[model samples]
Target: MSNFVTLLVEDDALQREVLADVLKDEGFEVLECTTGEAAELIIASTGTELQALITDHNLAGKMSGTELAHFARDRHPHLNIVIMSGTTVKPMPVGTAFLQKPFSPERLLDMVRE
Candidate 1:
């Protein structure tokens, strides 16, 4: 089993659950949140367990996915990030992976693996 841990942040309940299941199926330890604030709190509380972050570009709270990715990158430079969006937004930071919305589970897994 891989030792990688992934933090998944998505506002949509169904989407979050589906992604979580997919990650789990791939043998990753998954932590999920519906908002950036919740994701931030999880990272703050358990920074050591975090190996990567996967977030939706649009969230239900004050902070956007890009903002969360930036924050996580600031706090943990080694953490890998994958940002998913259905709409075009500001360009993502260099080196951060982007997954367009409606992406297949296999594609998402590939992004995380990369």
Candidate 2:
């Protein structure tokens, strides 16, 4: 168990599992969710406990990662936001970060560590 709690929202099952595994291995307690809406519920119920939010830009459900991040930020102002997108370069919001797809696990860890 780790002190940091990370929320991972990725609709792709395989990607989600692999990434979640990586975070787990790094001692991060990760809460996995398939959609932005699902993640929203977790954020609502467990706001202060969440230290970070890592989400896919193009989610399977109605909401995008941008929306989720904004909502989470509103609730948890200090939330560490990481947006992963393969389609195009997403505009980085205030106090948020971006990681283009096909990035290495090392890079991901580096961002979270920062």
The prediction achieving the highest lDDT against the true structure is 2
Deviation from native of the Cα of residue 93 in model 2, angstroms: 2.2
Per-residue accuracy of model 1 over 23-64 as CA lDDT, tens digit each: 999899888889999998887776667888999999998999
| Clashing pairs for predicted structure model 2, backbone only | none
What is residue 2's positional error in candidate 2, in angstroms?
Answer: 1.7
The 10-residue segment of model 2 with minimum total lDDT is: 87-96
TM-score of each: 0.92, 0.94
Q: Score candidate 2 by TM-score against the native.
A: 0.94
Alpha-carbon deviation at 103 in model 2, angstroms: 0.5
Candidate 2 displacement at residue 107 in angstroms: 0.6
- What is candidate 2's lDDT per residue for 1-114, written digit by digit as tens? 467999999999999999999999999999999999999999999957788999998898899999998898898998889999986745656788898899999989888877
